[model samples]
Target: MLTHLALKDFAVVQSAELAFGPGLTVISGETGAGKSLLVDALGLLSGLRADSGVVRHGASRAELVAEFSLADAQPATDWLRENALDEDGDDGRHCQVRRVVRADGGSRTWINGRPVTVGQLAELASHLVEIHGQHEHQALLSRPSQLALLDAYARNDAERRAVAEAAGRWSDLLAERERLTAQGDVSDRIGWLEHQHAELERETLDADSLAQLSIDHRRSAHAAGLLEACERAFAVMDGDEGPSITRALRQARDTLQRVAEHEPRLNEVDTMLDNAAIQLDEAAVLLDRIRGDLDLDPQALEALEQRMGRLHELARKHRVTPEQLAAKRDEIATELEALRGADERLQGLDADIAAATRAWQAAAEVLGATRRDAARRLSSDTSALIAELGMGGGAFDVVLEVLETVRPDPQGAERVEFMVAANPGQPPRPLRKVASGGELSRISLAIEVAALGLDAVPTMVFDEVDSGIGGAVADIVGQKLRALGERRQVLCVTHLPQVAAQGHAHYRVSKSASDGVTQSEVQALGAKQRQDELARMLGGVEMTREARAAARRLLSDAG
Candidate 1:
């Protein structure tokens, strides 16, 4: 249950902290007194989006926090445990959710002080609160919500899962069939793939071989210039015309050795000259070997150019680099192989689709019966409740119609709609089309009470659910809400004294503006204070003796 709520600069609330308890807690206030603002703050606990627009004027941001005691909320506790969101070294009996909205339209959320996604917050809150807004009538008018409510009421989760799974398998097979059909003219594609495959398979085109080939091509291209440079060097070193470097070094060594017998320093110089002459001779021999090996064969160069040109052409045709062509060829080959067995696969898919369709039909028939029966009972119970809410002679029906297609749907074989007639002798129409805003609120309240049988949420909030209802009927609505509170927590923001008097605890919300800043405040009322407020609600601007007496009678009867 929601234990405490705190708001900072949220709407015109300024700042407020409220501690709540189990049972029917009623909030009453004049219209525009921000009675529903309390509901809005609680809605934030459900991960509803907020922005600076929801912040009070001149505030930079809005902050909200809610606490829930999970003594009985096992589903929510289980969710926290599964997601690792529970606090350490503590029993999983308490949870705190906080949300902050910045003026720049940014927001942050936290669960137990740990940052969390809004989706996770919303999922956790679903088990904690079920809020019915005055304008959420669209949910009642929607077909999907109707079907979901029926299934939930029927508690046919197993049957529903079976139908959904069967439909999924059937849809998968159909999707595969469509994909193959769209790939038209498989034979042509396969033929092209085969040609490319043969080329790649027949050639050795790995990265290492390609790199070696690049080096060989460059060497062959520059062979003529390289051979000329090497021959000139050899001519200079071997002294083909003048004294070569080797011959000059030899002459220097001979002159130095003649003086070496007289001076030891001269011997060292002669030794260095001898080493230079030997290195020059070795260089000349290397030049001769390189010159002999050099070749500029026109036919061999032409073969290399043709090979490289073919690789480049294929790369361009496939819109890839030369290195990527091999991989792309293999990918196409794999697809082509699959196409070769398309006939066999298509036959298999047909058989699987037929089997899946049969399974779906079987599940749908079983689940559909439960849904229709639940729908009938739901409609009947809801209609009976509305009749007591001052809509005498009103009638409600749950219409189950088959979908337009023959294929099975995850939601079973039919769509459910809520139909109602507001008065006798009138044709039943869509609930929204038949009821005005006031009637819709009463109808929604009835539906909520009936659906509460299936809802496991720990808290239910109704904002002015008693709208456009008064007198004995308002008293009935209050009694029903009080009875619901016995099952779980119930919070209601009401304007009717009849409803207010039935509250296990009463709170009065008042709006005040000071220095052009508006603020709303709520305070728990004492017995005398509640009586005075109920009197004011009963008599409006003036609380006469009769209104006070009526308020007392209401409090007494409610007790």
Candidate 2:
């Protein structure tokens, strides 16, 4: 329920604070007294668009705050918790929504004093209150909103859950089918994969084989040059001409040994020469062994080249580097395995689709049955209400048309349309086409009152719902509004004294000017004051004796 509304510089409402309570609270005054300004302020606080023109002439900005008590609003509390906007408190349950519009055409919204986006505020406000008026009635004309309203009234939580689950399962199965189907012909791909696997298996190039092949290829590629270089080195190290450096170093060492007694440095030089001669001899032997091992194998080199060429070709065909060939091979192998199982997977998907279809059909059948039953009851109840509201001969019907294609949706395949016949023996037609503005208001009120018994919103506002009719009709509307107040907070703005007389609390909007600035103020009316206000409503600017007497009678009858 809306507990308090604080307005500052909003339109003609310069600065006003109105505290609201439970039951039917009516706002009444003469025309152009800025009664609608109060509704506009509440609208802004309820997440409606804000206009900069609403700011007072001398003020820089306009502010509107609406506070709601959420003690009985468990659905709203759960919604807040789901959105991570739940307030933290052990003292009590309450939620406050505030909106501020700057004179520069900028606005900001807040919930529980925490900054929030306009969309978030709107989402939260939608669950808190619903405003009905001449212009707002179009919300009911939408088909989707109508269906949602019906579903809300039915409270079909189980069926709704079933539909959602079936939709998710169907989506998942369809996605998997698409993925497997994109793999193309399994037989052809598997054959191609087998051929590639065979080719790689035949070559089987291990690390040792690769290393040996590289060595043999290098030797074969440079066979003549290597042999010539080895011969030249061997000859230089051990060829005749004085028995080479070995004999010369031996002779020098013997002479140095004899002179070592006189000069020890000569012994060191002779030792170095002997080591050099031994190293040369070892080099000659190594060169001889290398020359012997240098037989070129052309066949081995050709095989190595062929293997490397095939690897390169495969790399190019796969659009990968040679190093990635192994990984590509593994990926292709896995794909082939999956391809081999595609038929089984497809069969499994077919089963899943069938299962989902059956599940959806069952849930839809149950939902359709429930809606039909509820619609019958709703139509009869609304017809009774319509008769009570002074449309005695009117007939109301809730027509349900089942769609052929049963797509899984939160609200089944039922299309609900309200039909009406204003007189007996006349065929019923769509309510929007058959009802006038005033009749539509009454019909909407009837449906709202019936639906209100099921909806969870804590507050309901009707902006002149009692318009275009008076006397007993206005009284009946007031009675229904008061009856609705028994379950939820009801706020009504009206011009009818009959309706105003039924209010548990009354507020009067009056315009006043001070210092050349006009503003609107709202004050709660006392008993005598309400009598005068209702009398004025009955007799215009002057309260006549007859008008006062009629106002008193209306109030007495309302009580």
CA lDDT of each prediction against the hidden true structure = 0.84, 0.79
lDDT of 2 at 415: 88
Give lDDT tens digits, candidate 2, residues 320-353: 7666666677787787788888989998998988
How well does candidate 1 match the true structure in TM-score terms? Answer: 0.65
Clashes in candidate 1: how many?
0
Off by over 4 Å in 1: 44-53, 69-94, 102-108, 111-128, 136-142, 172-348, 425-427, 432-435, 526-528, 539-552
Tell me the tens digit of each residue's lDDT in model 1 across 1-559. Answer: 8888888988888888888899899999888888888888888778787767888888899999999988868889999999999977779989999999888878899999999998899889877887765554334566665677678788999999999999998999999998988887688888888988887676557888778878878878889999989977877777885788877887888887877888899987887887887777787778788888889898888888888888888888788988887788778778878999998888898898889989999999999899888888888998899899998999888888977777879878888888888888888898757447667767767887777735567877888788777878998999988877887788999999989988999888899999998898888899999999999998997999999998999999999
Give the per-residue Cα lDDT of candidate 1 at 152: 79
Model 2's C-alpha root-mean-square deviation from the true structure amounts to: 8.8
- Measured against the true structure, the TM-scores of the candidates, in listed sequence, are 0.65, 0.69
> Which residue pairs overlap in candidate 2's backbone?
none
